[model samples]
Target: MGVDIGGTKILAAVVTPQGEILAREKRATVAEEGPEAVISRLIGAIEAALSLAGTEPARLAAIGIAVAGMALPGEGVVAFSPNLRGWRDVPLRDIVARQLGVSTFLINDASAAALGEHCYGAGRGVNNLVYVTVGTGIGGGVIIDGKLYCGACGVAGEVGHMTIDVDGPRCNCGNFGCLEALASGTAVAREAKRHVAEGAETCLPQLVGGELEMITAETVFQAAQKGDPLALEIIAQAASYLGIGLANLVNLFNPELIIVGGGLAHMGNMLLSPALRVIRERAFEVPAQAVRLVTAQLGGSSGVLGAVAFALQQEAEVRP
Candidate 1:
């Protein structure tokens, strides 16, 4: 069993040892309802998936939870989560374990996605790689020498928080000029709305039927697809920032590949092509030449699949 708890949705799945999902369930996060309500929804999703698969909780080997926050898997606690306003020091693993009467483990959502990609997706057979998800916010995970490097304290892979522009917009983490603040889906929407507010000569406002608040990153992408100059400019700027961040990662990790995933990945060449150009221009010749950047193969299920991988790995580590 595996569960991915994100800001807007909870995904739970019953996956086979070979990384194939047998059944899955999804629920809206409705985080504004608070942590307790969110946890209740998460549990409900898991039970729904189990029922769909016709399997009992006790019949599962183990359960892994991918949380969108600073999760300390060693302590089974969610240290902090920007997505859920009131989640702090929440012992989620223990609560789920007790509720379901099964072993449960906690992992950072992006970190679990990295593990999933490494074991079953684009990073398969690659010893070193990075998995970056560009959605409501940017999140990342690093795999070094075939092992997930969670750092000394298990909160290591925060590639999005890396400050690229010293004077850029404020990030959700309360920092300035983070990659996420500049290049994520939220960033894209914010940039689009700002342009529309300034009366930019674009069809963005019309795309959202003059409701500026209804403008989203997808709306911007749609306008860009129609050759809207302002929309194209916004996407270009965001992709450039993303490329700079990826270049920094290339120079730092020198990994063989970087798997770009999440909602923005759907933009395909429009997002990656420009970012690749930036990476090649900014990174050192050897590292940039040696790296291959690609989109994630697993789509929306990556986090849950990663949780499944983590559960299997953890179970193996404790076997007699």
Candidate 2:
């Protein structure tokens, strides 16, 4: 069993040993309702997935959870989650394990996704790779020598928090000018809103039906697709920042591949082309020439699939 706990949704799946999903279930996270409520929902989703797969809890090998935060895998605690309101030092893994009577393991969502991609998606057969997910915020998973590196603190893949500009806008992590604060979907929408607020001559106001609050990164992309000058400018700026961030990763890791995924990845070449251009222009020639950037093949399924991969990896490590 594999569960992905996001800010707004809980997705559970029954995955085969061969990395195929047999059944899946999804439920609202309702994170605002507090930890107990969110835990209940996660359990419910797991049960629903099990039922759909016609498998009993006792028959399952283990359950792996992918959480969007700093998860202390050794302690079974989710130390903190920016997206999940009110979560602090929560013993999520133990709680789920006790309730379901199944061995449970916790992994950072991005790390799990990286494992998933390496095992079954874009990074398959690649020895070294970096997976960057750009969504509401940015996150990353690093693979070195074909192994996932969680750093000394298990918070290793926090590529989003990398300081891009020391004097740029403040990020939720209290950092100024982080790559995430500049290039994430949230950042894109924020910049677009600023432009609209300044009375930039764009159709964004009309597109959102005069409600600035409804403006989103997707809206900006839509307008940019239609040649809206302001929208294009916003996307270009964000893409440039993303390129710089990725270039930094390339220089640091010198990975053979970089898999770009997340909600923002749906923009495809519209987002990647500009970023690639910047990477080529700025990154070191040797690493830049050796690296190939590609979109993630697993899409939204990456998290749950990654959870399964984590569970399987744990099982292997414990054997003998």
Candidate 3:
């Protein structure tokens, strides 16, 4: 069993030993209602998946939860989640474990996605890789020598927080010029809102019916597809920053592959082509030439499937 808890929704799945998803369930997080409400919804989702699979709780080997934000997997605590309202030092793992009388563990969503990609998706058979999900925010997971590197504290794969520009816009994480602040979907929309507010000449306003607040990264992409100059420029700038972030990863890890996922990846070449060009211009030639950037094969299911992998791996580690 695997569950993924995000800011907006919760996903639960029953996965086979071979990484096949047998059944799954999803529900709104409604995080603003507080931790208790969110936890209840999470449990409900898990039970729904189990029911969908027609399996009893005792029949499951384990449950792994992948959550957005900082989770201390070893400690079974969600130390802090910027997106989960009122979630701090919450004992999510233990709570779920106790509630269902089933073994449960926690992992960062991005880290889980990385493990999922490495084990069953884009990074399969690769010894070193990074899985980066670019959406409302940017998150990453680094696999070194085919092992997940969680750093000294188990929260290491925070590629989004890396500083890109020393003097750029502020990020929700309170950092200036962080990669997430400049290249994420939120950043894309933020840029568009600014342009629209300034009365930029583009079809963006028409796309959102003059409601600047309705502009989103998807809206920008839609406009760009129609050759809206402002929209094209916004995407170009975001992709450039993304490329810079990837270049830094290349120089730092020298991974053989980098898997890009999440909502923004839907732009395909429009986003990746420019980013690849920037990477070639900036990163060391040797590493740049060796790294292959590709889209994730597993889409939204990556995190949940990764949770499944984590549960199985942890279980194996503890088996007598």
Candidate 4:
């Protein structure tokens, strides 16, 4: 069983060792109701998935949880989560383990995705891989020599917070000019709204029926596809920032592959092509040439599939 606990939703799945999802269930997180409520929802999601698969809790060997936060696996606690309101120091693994009567393990969501990619997705057979998820925020997962590197505190793969500009716009993390602040989905939407507010000529306002708050990164992509100059400019700027951030990763990690995933990846070549061009021009010549940049193969299933991988790995480590 694999559960992905996000801020707004909890997704649980019964997965086979071969990465096939036998059954799945999703539920609203209702995080604002506090940890206990959210945990209840998570448990319900798991049970629903199990019922759908026609399997009992006793038949499950183990459960893995992918949390969108800094999870201390050793402590069985979620240290902090920006997305889940009021979430701090919650004993997630123990709670789930006790309720389901099965061994449960916790993993960082991005790290889980990284492992999923490394084991079965685009980075399969690659020893060194970097997985960057570009969505509302940017998150990264690193596999070094076929091992996930969680750093000393298990919060290592936070590439989004990297400072790209010293005097640029402030990020929600209280930093100035983070890669996330410049290139993420949130950034794209913010930039578009800012430009439109400043009297930029574009059809976005009309598309959203003059609701500025309704502008989203997807909106920008859609407009750009139609040759809307303002939308095209916003995308170009965001892609340039993303390219620079990716170049830095290439120079630093020199991984065999970099898998770009998350919602923005749906933009296809409009996003990857420009980022690749920038990487070739800016990153170290040898490493950049040696590295292959590709889109994620798993898409939305990466998180749940990754949870299963972590569970299997944990079971393997304890067996011997």
lDDT of 3 by residue, 1-320 (tens): 98889999999999997889999999999999999999999989989999999997999999999999899988989999998999999999999999999999899999999999998899999999999999999999999998889898889989999999999999989989999999999999999999888878999988988788999999999999999999999999999999999999999999999999999999998999999999899999999999998999999999998988888888888884
Q: TM-scores for all candidates?
A: 0.97, 0.98, 0.98, 0.98
The per-candidate count of clashes, in order, stands at: 0, 0, 0, 0
Model 1: lowest-lDDT 10 consecutive positions: 311-320
Stretches of candidate 2 exceeding 4 Å from the true structure: none
lDDT of each: 0.94, 0.92, 0.93, 0.90
Question: How much does each candidate deviate from the true structure in C-alpha RMSD?
Answer: 1.1, 1.0, 0.9, 1.0
Model 2, position 118: C-alpha lDDT score: 95
Q: Of the candidates shown, which would achieve the greatest lDDT relative to the real structure?
A: 1
**Candidate 2, position 96, lDDT:** 92
In candidate 3, stretches whose alpha carbon ends up further than 4 angstroms from where it belongs are none
What local lDDT score does residue 298 receive in model 2, on the 0 to 100 scale? 96
Error of 2 at 231 (Å): 0.9
Q: How close is candidate 2 to the true structure, as a TM-score?
A: 0.98
Error of 4 at 124 (Å): 1.5
| Model 4 per-residue lDDT tens digits across residues 1-320 | 98888888899999998889999999999889988889888888999999999999999878989998888877879998988888899989988898879999999888899988888899888999899999999998999999888898777889999999999898978999999999999999999999999999999998899999999999999899999999988888888899999999999999999999988988877888888899999999999899888899998889988888988988889875
Q: Is candidate 1 or candidate 3 better by lDDT?
A: 1
